[model samples]
Target: MFPYFCLLIVTSFCAITEPFYKKQKSIKCILLSCFIVLVLFSGLRYDVGMDYLSYKTWFLSGRGFSEQGFILLTRIFRSLGPTIGFNFFVFIIAAVTLYGAYRFIYKYSSAPLLSLFIFFCFGQYFISTLNLIRQELVIYVFLGCLLPLIIERHFIKYTLCIATCSYFFHYTALILIGIYFLDRHFSAIIKLSGIALITISSPIIIYLIENSDYAVYLKLDIFVAKVTVLQYYLLALSVIIALLYFKCFQGKPMTKKDILFENINYINILFGIMIIMFSNTPIIQVISRLSYYTMPIYIILIPNFISRLSLRSNRLIFRYAFILLYTLIFLVAITTNGKLQHYVPYHSIIF
Candidate 1:
């Protein structure tokens, strides 16, 4: 709890100070400081995250690795064995995840520090890294490779990127290939209809998968539970913010990057709605994983939308609103989720 709060405070301070710095060097220093804090705090943790024990055990025994990349990483670190090696493994994962996220935010975000704040606070992305190290790593890979290809409208490159990432990483990431089509300049009506169709069809797909041999792939029964009420509220809140952005851009011209980002956000909201719609189903985990693929868009979308506001007062209002709303969500999540409950009384190898 102390460590998490410390990170929030540090990130907030950096975010507030960033716009005033102006100098590239000063900005880099500030960003670097925040990144270091993120890496060190995440890397140093012991028994302080959702899957810390499980991952450590896997590292020691050399099993439970699903992805080939992760298997290779485990084997490389097996040389150290036991505690020391596992700590190093966690450190490497933290470094890779934060590096990818920070690099993406720096490249795409209007306010990188604010985006970092969201990365830490919104949807527990930073916290979840302790549990989903491989997923987060694979997500960043998709963002780095698939994003540019989608924005530039390179079909062949996009397909190849998905195939390559899927082979090396999680097969679930292959679900992201759907984004390439969704990224196109489809009319809003068509896109909205598609969102509705997907949401509507989720249960049917879940049933079919459950009945088939592929049920093992989804692992739907292991973590059977409903998404929390607070989670649904957050998803609803995301949709509202997205709608505000949608209304703002109506009838306005958009650059290619902006158009794709805009659609990406809409797709993100669609996943949010899907989670809410399927809150009761066994397929909640699948929806949650799919949601993660688009979740990074929030770091970019929310900040970009706020910056686009026509009035300074509106900007300030929304900025504060954003922080407050997410802070409340963060509080509720930590209290409610069993895995997040483990985040309390943070421990580190150094201490």
Candidate 2:
């Protein structure tokens, strides 16, 4: 814990002190130092996460028709065995996620360091990566490709990248591809309709899980759990933040880039809420796959909303409220989830 916080402290200091846009060399050096610490921390771990053993087995077995990208990785590691392969995989994920996330912050965010802090606080940077290994890789890889895909309009490169990602994680790839193509503003009526559907569908899904005689046959038995209230809370908070940002911008001039980002953020928010509403449905894994894909939006929007505002009052409120929210999330994570028990007494393969 002490060691880890050192990394965060150094990172936060670098983040807080980073100058505006002039010294590329200094920025690169700090980021590089952070990345090195991150890679060492994640890559050298031994049996650290809940699914560590399972992933080791998966790496060794290397058996799967789907997610050929991971399968291919497993195959490469098969020659060296699970330990080496697992570490290599971890190193790669840490490297790519850090680079991609930092790049994303540099490009789109008004507050790069604050966005990085949010990424850490929001669990995408450290906690989620430790557990959801494959998903993290896919999500970050897709994030790295996002600028080329949409912002820069590099269609061919984006398509190729998406194709490669789909080969690795089909469900996420499909969702991402769909999002890429449909990055347009929906009318308020359409957005509200989707939320209404989520509200109305909850009970129906619960009933199906409880009463259906063929629940096992339909795989509803696998998804017999209830919608996670924590996810709902998160969704609600995100909506409030987005709404606040939008409210601030009313009657103000917005750049085309800002409008585009806002539209896409709305879509991502809706996508997350829809998944949360369907959390107990038979396709819950698919829903889970899709949720991580929406994270880049969270990364961009939260800091952007807080730091980009001309209204200092809004900035103070949003920033403080965000910190408070993160505290609540931490408390809830430790108290509410059993699986996260694996994370306690944090250990690594190397000290």
Q: Which prediction has the highest TM-score against the true structure? A: 1
Clashing pairs in 1: none
Which 10-residue window of candidate 1 scores lowest in summed lDDT? 332-341
lDDT tens digits by residue: candidate 2, 1-351: 555456556655655564354676666666656666776777777676787777777777776346867688667766675666677776776677666666766677665655665666555445677777766766766665465566556667777777777776454565666555544455568867877877788668757766777566345465544556656665675687668656876777766556556665666566566666656566555565566766556666777766766787787677666656655665466445524546555567665
Output the lDDT of residue 79, model 1: 88
How does model 2 fare in lDDT?
Answer: 0.64
Q: Which regions in candidate 1 have their CA more than 4 angstroms from the true location? A: 144-146, 154-161, 199-223, 335-340
What are the root-mean-square deviations of the candidates from the true structure over C-alphas? 3.4, 3.8
- Model 1: per-residue lDDT, tens digit, 94-122? 88788888777877888777888888886
Error at 90, model 1, angstroms? 1.5
The residue pairs in collision within model 2 are: none
Q: Rate the local accuracy (lDDT) of all candidates.
A: 0.75, 0.64
